[model samples]
Target: MKKDVRGMLKDFTDGLAAISETNKANVNAFMRLLNTGYKEGALSTKTKELMSVAIGVYNRCEYCIVYHVYKSLEAGATREEIMEAAMVAVGFGGGPSMAYSATLLKDSIDEFENDFK
Candidate 1:
């Protein structure tokens, strides 16, 4: 969730709940660019998905970790790959962050596995 993003979630969720066409339009534009960069081309969207999970783990973003784990599957990432990515994040992100992120990521782990079946 990044450091300051927690404070912004309310407004963001509120805006989302309101179904503001303007916000949707603007976010769609951003999504196009991001999806192109991360999901298209030969960049291997799985890699980006893993990276997102790693960042979510590192930043301790509960919702982000959950969503990214799901998105990882939606992006064609495997459970082993996602687990390995989280392992790497644990190494680089350290004990507390690693532990916290693992707990958060755990919920999505099962869902991701089932998604493949």
Candidate 2:
């Protein structure tokens, strides 16, 4: 992988923090929305995280893919479950999504899957 998945996560975290320093209102709103979205609802948190993984892949958002993959595992999704979600994205998103699923998503799993165990 061109970028280490863990490093990408760290960088994203740092970047978010820096942005939050200046863009506090928007950042706080975004964080609230994120927390609300990820909170358990009709769907379990694990299911939500899996859905996020698929959405991230479909959108080709590298940082989102890394974050949600890690969160999915943390929420107790198995590697297989994560992959299945990514495949669902590929179905909708076609080759562009597949490319991310095959590359960045796979790398994110490799880098973070064991961390949950």
Candidate 3:
């Protein structure tokens, strides 16, 4: 069966929140660390998001890809930029990354854009 990537993401996030609630302090700390790492320093948020897209592709995590793609768009990364980042992942990860980028990345981008429109 075909996956509903957006729905799966929502469910995963909801599940994560529920799990995190059982250990709020630790989860909060981890979230804080994530926020701190992603915050603007030498690299802009958009740059970080682009990097995330590449990492997501290399890792072949659909959840990661969807989340980072949405975040990248919010951070003002154009489709072209995201695609370029995916290409970079393909360079490192070879065929697996290429497959993920061509399928999952494209689907995520289309889904995200459609939702916003």
Best by TM-score: 2
Q: 1-117 in candidate 2: lDDT tens per residue?
A: 356999999999999999998999999999999899889899999999999999999999999999999999999999999999999999999999999998999999998988988
RMSD to the true structure for each prediction, in A, is: 5.6, 0.9, 1.5
- For residues 1-117, write the lDDT of model 3, one tens digit per residue: 346778867986897799897988888898898799899999999999999999999999888998898888888888889999999999999999999888888888877865544
| TM match of model 1 to true structure | 0.71
- Could you tell me which residue pairs clash in candidate 2? none
Where does candidate 2 have its weakest 10-residue lDDT segment? 1-10
Output the lDDT of residue 71, model 2.
Answer: 94
TM-score of each: 0.71, 0.96, 0.91
Error of 2 at 63 (Å): 0.7
- lDDT (Cα atoms) of all candidates against the true structure: 0.71, 0.94, 0.87
lDDT over C-alpha atoms for residue 81 of model 1: 83
TM-score for candidate 3: 0.91
